[model samples]
Target: MDNIAGTKSSLVWAVNIAVVVLVLLWTIPTFGLLVSSFRDRDQIATTGWWSSLFPHEASLRFRIGDAETQRQEGEVFVIDGSVFEAGGTVSAFGTSNRDPAAHEPGEVVDFGDGISGTVNEDGSYRVTSPVAFEGRSPRLFVTSVTPPRFTLENYDRVLFAQGLGRAFLNTMTVTIPATVIPILVAAFAAYALAWMEFPGRSLLIASVVGLLVVPLQLALIPLLQLHNAIGIGKDYLGIWLAHSAFGLPLAIYLLRNYMVGLPREIIESARVDGATDFQIFLKIILPLSFPALASFAIFQFLWTWNDLLIATVFLGNTQDQLVMTGVLRELLGSRGGDWEILAASAFVSISVPLVVFFAMQKYLVRGLLAGSVK
Candidate 1:
């Protein structure tokens, strides 16, 4: 009964649970990255994104008032001021680095010879000495608990100082043409294979499938040499052609599969009406194949947009031509230790792909129609 039609399988529940788990697995890191992008380096280093909403305790070193800030109060020279100029609560403090939290706030430490210092919970500090203060005031290490803070400075620095703005436009330049040209060319090829009779059609389809498994790394150097020979050396045109070539096989395979699945009656009736192949394709086939086209568009857009190797090989890595991935690679090398900047740059790079995916996701499953119909 469990295997019968209109009955549920025991594994269905397990599959649903697995899918929810997978979605959360992917979403959690992305959410963390978004949170981290808005934070400064210090907070990110000290705490995780989940802790960003609460106060964070950190041990910090601050210099007390220097000799110039000291004033004579009766017979005693005194230095009085808050260690934090803006905000922070001192929970504990010490005058030596070895025991930074040796004393609680509001407790005084007597250093002998009539020298004493005290720090209060409100970050205020006072030091009194019988002798005049000298250069280089005392170093105070305090444990402070600060309220949560967020900022847009990370985005500002990444988009402007890191050159991501220019790289963004360059990636758009490469990806848009790379995606469209392949889809247009593959649409024609797919229509011919699906409907129009032609010699060697089976061989061509077989070749397309064969190319799908072939790794692109095998052709990078050879393709670069070919680009140079054709006088298209190291330009957007060359990279566009490279992406289109690599993407075409999959594009044609998918569109052909979906086009072949369309009801045969429509094509036969169009042919009987004296319609040419181009007319059948433009008027009849293209409109019906929108799901497949959109599906391929999403794939090619994401692949070309995220591509680093092809862009590096065909488009020279000049600042004028660097893509988003290359610019991010440069950032990773130069600012590898700055997690905030890296998080911001990474989020910016994936923003467009996320939008494109969600926008066309409905068509994605519809286009995977291979062998669905006899």
Candidate 2:
């Protein structure tokens, strides 16, 4: 008994260590992405996400004032404000994103005809006028020290500005129905396959398994045309049917395997008790097959949540019908530089799957153990 206990302890320790390592490997980068998603766009580009927890200093430059805005406040015709601050290094300055770092910051790099700003150690710079130099505009240069940035701007941008909350609601609508419909249909089919006696059953099951191998990509255009012919194109019902059809094959296969593993005696006794096929299925088969159902629900929820290709193809990517994938794709086009927005968007998209997994994982184990002993 002592030896057995020692062996079990060793196995548990090994399993725990493995689980810990795997979790960390998966979570560290995800956490980094989460932090990056909350940072300023420029800050995101400059430093690693882990460095966000500590203070950071970066250099930048700005024009003191427009040429027209400049007034004779003093005899020197002074440019009073400082462009750059003390903490960050101002290595360069430029007028545009393309020329953003053209002149090295803090070097007091000379512009022709005495038009230049000297960045001070305190982060302020003063540009002096020639006293006779006249132009329609003042040439802009900038320097600055920015503190470490953390912002909720990404959440605001994605959730409100980009209408991602609406997309999220749309996704939930599509995902819930898409997941439920197939499982309902597949459960019936799987019960019939496992428990009903009918001719050509093996052949029918074989046909479904075969359909699993057929690439969904090949069917996209044909399906769209089919939906359009049937007057269901570019609508919620069409996309739901599309998702259900795509999810059905695997769902039936899994449930059928699990149901067939159930003891024949229980089903036989239920029938002997004068329970009809429908009653037996509802009372005996369903209650026992829950683990399998829960397991499949988890898979369906995750797949539907993350589906970019099918949602885009079936739903017609309109603003009203647009799901999370469509929204994320739009964000990539419009605000690709915003890491915080991307991170928050990704987190929102995945939140449901994580919750479902945690809630239902126990059923997966219970379902797999089903019929094992019998």
Candidate 3:
């Protein structure tokens, strides 16, 4: 008994540690993406997401007001301004990009030819020359420890400038009907296969099961040709039909298996009460199949929502029809270096699926377990 107890305790600790490791593995990258989305471009480029949560030392180079804005002060040409708009402490400053932060703030540095500049700790700067300043405004570089900063500008740019907002709506336009139409058709087919006897029923079930192993990519070209031949070329309707057709096999298999597990006595009792097959399905099977329906709905919804290949092949990549995945792919090609935009766009694209999963997860688990056990 003592040895058994010790073994159980060791097993429990091992399981708990494994769970912690798994959770961290899944969560860390997602957390980083979420944090990066709210950051500005410079911050994202300069530091990792974890470092953005704390005050950190950073360096920046900028130019003072142009020479055109200079004033004659006491026989000297002068340009004066604050380097930071919202006011920040400056630790060091420099006039040349090659040696940024070369001089401590408050130290006046003389540039040969009678040009001198001073940057105060408060980020205010003044440049003076006995002769008129020429060429352009002198550059200033500062290194300072800055407070944590974040912005929604990335989201703003992705949604409006990069066209992700329109893509989001386009994805919805494809996903909603694609998810709903197939469930309705699959539910009726599943009911017939499960309860209402018909010829070649077993063969049909076997065919659906076989289709589960068939690769969708294999049929892409053939299906595209078929759609085009039937005058449904490269449109929302065409994509919807493609998604529904691709989704149906699994949807029917799940629903039929779940329906087969329902208490046959209930279906039989309803049938004897002068209730037709459709009536029995509507009044009895539909309500009891809620878990299964929710499960397949969530599955089809997610699959359609995140689909890229089908959308790309069936729908044209126009601004009006491009989905979020296509927009993300475009961003990857065009804005590959823009991590903030990519992170924000990815978060926006995934938000709906996360909500749907969390909302229907309980039903999905219940349906899977019920179907598996019976």
- How does each model score on lDDT? 0.89, 0.76, 0.89
Q: Which has the higher lDDT value, candidate number 1 or candidate number 2? A: 1
Error of 3 at 118 (Å): 6.3
- In model 2, how large is the Cα lDDT of residue 99? 65
TM-score of 3: 0.82
lDDT tens readout by residue for model 3, 88-153: 688888878888878988999987688898999988889899999888767788997677788888
Query: What does the lDDT read for residue 226 in candidate 1?
Result: 91
Error of 1 at 320 (Å): 1.4
Error of 1 at 261 (Å): 1.2
Per-residue accuracy of model 1 over 1-374 as CA lDDT, tens digit each = 65576646567888889999999998998899899999988778878988887887889898888899999999999999998865878889998899999999999997566789899999999999999988777889999988788999999998998888889999999998999999989999999999888799999999998998799899999988998998999998898888999999889999999899899999999999999999999999999998889888888888999999888888988878999999889888998988899999999999998888888777655554442332
What TM-scores do the predictions have? Answer: 0.84, 0.71, 0.82
- Give candidate 3's whole-model lDDT: 0.89
Clashing pairs in 1: none
Candidate 2 per-residue lDDT over residues 67-134, each given as its tens digit: 66555646545565655433454445654445666665455645556665565545555666667346
User: Any runs in candidate 2 off by more than 4 Å, and if so which?
Assistant: 1-25, 58-149, 363-374
